[model samples]
Target: MPNYWGPFAQLKEQTNAILEVANYNGLMAELNDALFIDRSDIAYYVDLAKEAGGPILELGCGSGRVTLPLLSGGYHVTGVDNSQDMLDILSKRMQHRSREEQSRLTMCREDARNFQLGNAFSLVIFPYCSLLLFTDPADRKSILKSVRRHLTSSGLFAFDAPVQESLNQERIFELDLPIESGKTVVTLGIKTYHEQKVMLENSLFQVAKSTNKRYTILEYKKLALFAEGELEQELQEAGFYVYKRIPTLSDNGKTLRYLYVCGKSDTDTYPLWHPYMPHNQLPNHVLTLVSGQGCRVTDQHGKTYIDASGGLWSVQCGLGNTYIIDAITKQLSTLSYGTLFAGRGNEPALALARKLVELAPYPLEWVYLTGSGSESVELSIKLARQFWHFAGLANKNRIVYLDQSYHGTFFGSMGVSGLYPAKETVGPGLPGLDCINAPNPDNCPPNQDYETYALTCAEQLETVARLKSDQIAAFIIEPVLGSAGVVIPPQAYFDRIAEICQRHNILLIVDEIATGFGRTGAWFCSTHFGIKPDIMLLSKGITSGYLPLGATLFSAEIGNRLLAHGAGIMHGSSHNGNPACCVAALATIDVLTNQQLIKRAREAGHYVRELLEQMKNEQPNVSGIRSLGLMAGVALCQNDHKPATKEQVAVIYELLKRKGVLAYPAVSSVVFFPALTITDDELQTVVQKLGEVLSSVQLVNNGTRMR
Candidate 1:
C-alpha cells in the first residue's frame, strides 16, 4: 500500500544513499532500536492475528517490525513489500532466529498495489499507515481487490489508517535509544501536512550520548497518510464489510489511528447490479454458475440443472458452442478489436452486417451495430427522431410503447417503456413518450373473440396516432413479450397494428431482442407476423450470448433517408461493431442456418406446447399457459382463478430448482426458455418437473395460503 518507487523514487534514492554510508553498517538494528521501540500496537495486532487464525500476509512490512513479532508469537507470516532493501533487512533479522522460527516467516518483494502470492491466507494485515500512501483511487482499489482475492472465505483483512485530527498539524520529535554503554541511536521525526494528506519523514543517526555528536546517518524514511471514512467507503465499494474498528491513540495521546477488520460480503463479491433484483434481500445461497454444456449448467457446488432459462432467453444455439468460440478466437488472433466509426470498418463487422440483412425480414436492408440490447434500443430511438428531423417533421419525436413492455434499461429506452415500477424507480421518463395497452388476449372482454380483442387493442394505437400524429415518431412493440411472462399476441393483432401505423404515418418499431435468432421458430418475430417494421431492435441471441453485440435494423425507406441526411447518424459506441463480437454473431447465424435450428425450434415449440397443455389440464393451479417456440410461461393461480402471489411464484421456482430445473419467475408465472438444441427427453423432464411442482403448491381458498 506504500507508494514505493512508483511516484516517490526520490525517497527510495534517499534511503539508498543513507544505506551506502560506511559508518552506518548496522542500520536495521538502529531502526528497530530507535523508531519501533515502544509500539503498543504490536500486542493488539497479535490478538487479531490469533482471532483471525494465521497464516497471515503483512503487506508493506518494513524490516521485521510486525512480521517478526507475529512469527515470535507462534504464527506463520508472509511479509510483502515493494522494496527489496526492506525485504533483505527482514531476511537478515530472520537469520538470527531458530530454524523453526525462521521457517514461520516468508518475505517477498512485491508491489502492495498489485501482487500475486499464489496462496490464500487467513489474515491479511496492512500495518502502519501504508494504505494511506496509495492516494490514487485506482491503486487503492487494486490493493483492496488483491487482498480480497488472497483471503480465504472466512478470513479477515485488517488495516490501520490515521485519523483526520492526527494530520491536522505538523510536529517533530527526537528519540534516543542506548545501543551500547556510550553509543546511542538517535531518530529525528518530522511531520508535514499537504492538501489532503500528511507526510512523515524520519532520519536515523548514531551519536555519542556524552558528546551529542552525530556519527553517520543510518537511514531516511517517508510514510504516507490517509483521511478517515475515505478508506471505509472504498472498502465497501470493493465488496468488503468492516465488522470492527479498533481505535488506538499515539504514545503522546494526541494522534489517533484505527484498525479496520473486514470480511468478504460473500464468495461472489462481483458488486454487480442485477437488473430488477432487490439488493437488500439478495439470497445468501445465490447460485454461482461455473460452467455449462448444451442445455445444462453446473453451479459451483457441482450440481447441474437443465438451463430452462437459456441464459435469459439468449442461448438459442445452446451453451459452449465450439463454432462460435472458434470464430471468436480466430477473429481475436487477426484483428482482436476494431471500431466501425468514422467510416473505419473491419471485415467481420461488414460481413456480419451483410449476413444480418440477408436473413432479416423483408425491407430491413441496413444494420446499425451496437454493444447490447439496451444500446440497440437507445440508438433506434435516436435514429427515428433523426429521420423525422430530416423529413422536416421535427415535431414528430414522441415514442409510444405498449403496456407491460420492456424495451431496454437505458434512459431513452426505459423512458419509452410501459412498466410502471421501472418508470417510477428510474425517476422521470423521457419527454414526449407515451404508453398504450398491448394486445393481451387474457385481458379481453368476456364476450369478445380473439380477433375482436385484437382489433380493440389495435385501435388504441390509431387513437394515439390521430391525436398525437404530429408528435408521434414511432410505435414500438415486442412481437411476443418475453420479459412480461412471454405474452403471445393473437395473429390478428400485428396485421391490424401494421395497417394502423402505416395509415397514420407512425413508424412501427419491432423489438425482437429476446424473440430474435430463431427463439420463436423464425429468424425474427416480425417475419412470422408478416409485418415490415420501419425499425427493429435485436440482441441477446444475436451471438447466442457468446459475446456482447446488438443490432438496430432499418428498412430501406428509413435507412436511405437517414443516410442522405447531412447530419448522419450522430451516435456510436466505443465497442460498436467490435470484430470479435461480430465474428461470434456470424458464427451463431451460421450454426442456426447450417444445423437447421430454426426448423428444430418449430418442432420444439410444438412439443413444449403439448406438454405444457397437459400439465395445465392436470393441475388446476396451472390456470393459464402461453408459449411461442422455445419461450413459454405457465401462470399459477388460486382455486378461484386469481393470479398467484409473489411468494407463491417464489415457492414454485424453488420447487422447480429442487427438481433440477432452472426457470425464471416473472410475477405470478414460471417462464421457461430452453436452448433450441435441447433434446425432447430434456424438454419432457423440465415440463414434468414443473407439473410436479405446480401440483404440490395448492391454495386452499384463494386467501394466499398454500397446503
Candidate 2:
C-alpha cells in the first residue's frame, strides 16, 4: 500500500489477494518449464556473470528458477521475492543440494522496489517482466535508482520485459505439468487489457481434461511500454547507460522477450552544480576546468584534453584568450550588471547588437538578447506569435519544426520538437505545434536521389502550410542538425524552403546554436545556405563559453510591425543586457575577426575533414563522415550499414577518452565540434587515436573485444 495512484491504482483494484497467494508448491516451477523454459536467459546471465565477475542479486526470483541455475554455474546468488510461499518452496528444494551449493544461495522475501541487501553487487537481474509488477513509472524508477546505488562502478543491471504486442491477447495459451503418474496439473492463461493495464487470468486444473475442479489466479500487471528509442532516453535519465539489448528466447528458440543490459553511468556530481546538462543526467565528473590556452583544457585531475566540443560548441576564440578574459574582467569591475527593462539598456548591449546587425545577412537587422539558447527560442516563438497577433493575424499561432532538430528545452521550444523520446517526459507542449520530416540524406528513400529527397522534404512543409496556412506561424529548422548526429541537409534544401515560406507568408526560422561563431566556415551556418531567415536564433558561441548569452536576429519588418500601435513586446530576461556577457561577446568577436579565425576555421576545418575522410576510407566500420567547418561527425556501423549499437558506441568513446581525446557521443556516431583554433598536430593525434580506437573495438561473440 505505497499510496498507489493513476495507472498503479488501476492494477491494485483489479488484483485479488487469494489469487496472489494461492501460491506455488513446485507446481509453478513445473508449469514454467511446460510453458517455455527460456534457457537462453540462463546462458546470457552466465556469460555476463563471467565477464562482470558477479555476486548476483536476482529480484523477483520466483521458486529459484534462474537462481538455482546460476548457483550451479558457480555464481554467488541472492534471490529476493515478495512471495513467502515461493521462497518456502525454493528453500525446500535447496535442501537436497550440496553444502557448498547451499552456502552460495541466499534468500530474502522482499519487494524489488524497496529491497536492500547491505552490499553492492556486480550484476542485478530482474527477469520475467518483474518490472511490470510496478505499474507506476515512479516506482519503477525507484527500483532502478536502488539498483544503481547497489551496483559496483563497473557492474551491470539487466532486466527482461515481454513486448506489448506479444502479450497473450487471445487467451488460448496453455501449459500442462504432470505431478503423479497419471494425474496432470494444467494451467490455462487468459490475458486481457483494461485501459492499457494487463490482466492474466491463470486457471489451474487437477488434470489436462476439464472437469470443473480449478483454482484461478488473477494476475494484474501494468507496465510502461517503451517507444522505438525511448528506453535509452529513460535509462540515461535514470543514471544508467544501456550498453546492449539481447533477445530472451523461448524453448523453441524464437524471440519471446527482450533484455536490456546497462551499466551505471559515472555521474556522482553531487555537490549540486549541474549548470547546462541537456539530457537531465548528472555530470559524469564534476570537472572544474581549471585553466587553458589555445584549444586544450585541464581538469582538476591534472589531465588535459582537446576542448573538442568547445564546451558545448562555444569558445570560438579558444580557451584562455587573455584579450577576451581581460575584457570580461574589466566589464565585471565596471558596469557589471545592467538590465534592458523599461526602455533602459546598456552601451555594451547596444554596441554588441549594432555589431551583430552589421555582420548579419542584409535581411536580419533587428536583435533580441537572451540568457541561453533555449531562452532565445522562447523569445523567438513569442516574437513570432506576437508579431502576427499585433498585425491582426492572431489565427496564425502554430510553429513547425524539422524532424530530429533540437531547438531548445523551454516548454514552447520543446512543443515544436520532433524527437519525441527526448521530450516525452515533459508535459504536453504548447498547442498547435507541428513538425515535418527533415531532409536527411541517410533517410532518403531507396528510389529517390538526394535532390529529390530534399525537395520532397521541402514539399512536406509546403503541404502542411497549404493545409493549415492560417494556423501556421513559422517553420523552424536547424542549419545543421546537431543532436541528430550532425545531419547536414542537401545544398538546395533551404532555398526551396525559403521560397515555400515566402509564398505562404510564413516566417522561416533557422537555429544556429551549434554552428555559429566560426564553428562553421561561415560566421553563421545560416550564411552557408545563402538564405536570410525571417527569424534567426543564436547562442553557444555568443559569449564563447565565458558567459551565458544568446540572441534572436530577425528582419526589421517584423520588428517594426510588433513595435507598431504602442504594442510593446513583453519578453526579456532579468540579465538580458548584462554588460559582462556583452563585453565577453564583443571581445570574442574581436578575437575571431582580428585573428581571422573564421578563415582559419575554413582552412583547419578542411584539414580535419580530409583526415576524417581518409580514416573513413581505411576503416570497415565507418559508414559516413559529415562536416561543415570544425563541426564534424563520423558514423560507425556494423557490416549491414545500420548505425552502431550502444555497446559499440561506448567501446569507441571509452577508447578515445583513454587516448586523451574527448568527443561528444550520439546514439550511433561520434561527433566533434573542436575549437576552430585546434592545430594540425592535434588533428593528427585525433586521427591516429581514432584509428587505434576503431582497431580496438571489434566486438566478438563472447561479449568482449577481439584480441
Candidate 3:
C-alpha cells in the first residue's frame, strides 16, 4: 500500500473499473439500439443541421444514428468515433446508400479528443449526450480544442449534455424491447451518483425464441456532473462562447439537458504559438496588447507601458502615425495588391524603389524588394551565389558572417545567425558559411586600444579571404550586432573590413535591417562608418513597423552584370513590392525626414548615455553602457564581475514592468530601442525606473551584491 495524505485518499483507488463500452462486443451496440432507439431525437438534430450547413463533422458518431440522417438529408458529413466495431456497423449501413450519397460521407475511427482531419468544417456536432462521455474536465477541454481547430472562421460547434443539477440521485430501471425475428432485448441500468460524477452500469440481455437461448454482456458509462458555471468558464477558456442555449427534457422529463450552440470567440479563439516560445507554455511576462499610440501601448487590462523597445527594434516613427496610416488606406483603395512579377509593376512600388535608390550611397542605383527582412536576407544569399555563378566563378559560393550577428530567421539567414540557439537545433544550414568573432569592446584584450582590437578582429576576415578567396562570394555583417546585445565595434573595424573585401574581390553584404532608417541617427549605419557596401539589406524601420517591407540594394556594377545575364531574376515573392507596403514605406520615410527624427535620435543618444552614466554611478550593477543614436544597451553584472544570470535579469524586468516601463532584455544586458519620436520626459522616466529596479534587485542564491 502507498502512503496517502489527503481527505480524498480513500477515493484514489477503486476496485470497480471504468467501462470500455465503446470497444465492447457487437451485442452491446445492438443493446444500445434497443434501449434508446427512439428515432424521435433525430428530428431535433435535423433541425440543427438545417441551421448549420453542410461539410459537417459529427463527433462520437456511433453506428451512424445521427450521421446517417444528416447524410440522407443532402448534407456532407464526416464521422469520427473511437470504436471500430461501431464504425464497421456504420460502414455496412453506408454501403446500402447510393454511390452519390456515399461519396459525401467520410468515416474515421479515432478519438474525438485528438483527431486531425486536415479539413475545416462549417459545423461540428456532438449529439445525443456524446460530450458527457468524457468525465474528465481535461478531456472535455481537449475535445473542444480539437473542434476549434477543425472549424472554419465562422463555423459553429454544437453539443448536448445533461445539466449537472439533474444528476442528483441514484436510480435503477429495466427495459425490454422486441427486435427483428422473434428476438427480445432487456437492459438493466443501475445509476450510482458521486459528488462530481455519475456512473451507469448496465447488464444487457439478448434472447432468441427459436433456440430458447440468451446471452448477456456488462457495459457501463461514467459522465461528469460539472459544478455550476464550470463548463461555461471552460468553454470561454477554449476560445468559444455559447451563442445560443436551449433547455430540453430527456428520459421523460426526469433529466434536463442543454443544447449549446457555440461560436468561436472573435479574440484569440484558438491559441497562437509565438515565435521562439515553447509550444507547451506561455511566458509569464507576456501581455496581450489592445491598443497603442505615441511611445506607449496599453495591455488588455487597460494598463499602459512606455514602448521603450519600440516593438523588437522596429516602430521607428512611433505607433499610430496618421501619415503612414493614411498612405496605407489610400493605397489599399487605389491598388489593394499588384504583382511585381512578369514585368508588371504598380506606381507605389516603382516610386518606393526610386526613393530607396536616391537615399542609398553611390553606385547603389538599383533595388529589389521583398516582404520582410528574412526574405531579404534569403534573397541576398541567392543573389550573392548567383552573382558569382553568372560571372563564371561558380566556385566562389562561400559566405562569411560575424559572430553575434542576427540576419533573419529563414533557413538561409538562420545559417548565418551568430546566436547558436537560433540555428543550432535546426541545422545544418547553407554550406560554405564561416563565422569570425564580432568586434565587441567588452571582448577586447586587456590594455589594448579599442581601434586596434577592432582592426585585429577585422583582420581575421581578411585571413579567411586570403586562404579561401577563390571560393568566397560575399562577407555579411550587421552595422552593430543588434541581437547580440547591441555590440558596437569601433569605426576603424569597418574601414579595414571594406578595404580587405574590395582587395580580395569579395562582395560586401551589409545587413542594416535593424539599424537602417535612422535607428543609428544616420539614414543608414553603414554611412556612419563610411563603408560603401556592395549590397545593402534593409527592413524593420523601413516602414516603421506600420507594414512589412524589405529591400536589397545592389551596386551599379553588380546590378548591370545581373541584368545583362538576361534570365531576369532567379527569385521573387508573390507580394514583392506590394503597393500598400510600398506606400507605407514612403510615408514612413516622409515622416522621419519631415519631423527631423534622425537628428533627434542623435540628440536622444547623448541624453540617454548621460542618464545611464548617472544611473551607473548610483547603482554598481551596471558594468557597461553602449549606445549609438536611439539604440543602447546597459550591461549588468554581479559584484564578482560575472554577467548577471537569466533569473536575476528576469527579476529586474518584472520590476521594470511593474513600474510601467517596457524594455528588452538581451542576454545579460537590458537594451533600449525607444522610438525616435520619444520625448525627453518619456526617456527619463524609463531610465529612472530601471535604475530603481537595479538598486533594489536581490541577488539570487548566492546573495552577492555589486556594491
- Please report the candidate that would top lDDT against the real structure: 3
Cα lDDT tens digits for candidate 1, 506-598 = 888889899899998998887777878888889999999989999999988887786676467877978998999999999999999999999
Mind giving the per-residue lDDT tens digits that candidate 3 earns over 211-313?
5645444454556666778888888789787765665556775546677878776553236778886633332225779999989999977889998999989
Better of 2 and 3 by lDDT: 3
Q: Which sections of candidate 1 miss by over 4 Å?
A: 1-270, 283-285, 420-422, 699-706
Local lDDT at 371 for model 1: 94
Backbone clashes for every candidate come to 0, 0, 0
Score candidate 2 by lDDT.
0.76
TM-score of 3: 0.62
Worst 10 residues of 1 by lDDT: 1-10
Q: Per-model C-alpha lDDT, please?
A: 0.78, 0.76, 0.79
Give the per-residue lDDT of model 2 (tens digit) for 487-566: 88876888888888888888888888788888888888877778778888888987788899999899988888966767
| Residue ranges of candidate 2 with Cα displaced over 4 Å | 1-292, 420-422, 645-651, 698-707
Ten-residue stretch with the least lDDT total in model 3: 1-10
Per-model TM-score on C-alpha atoms: 0.62, 0.66, 0.62
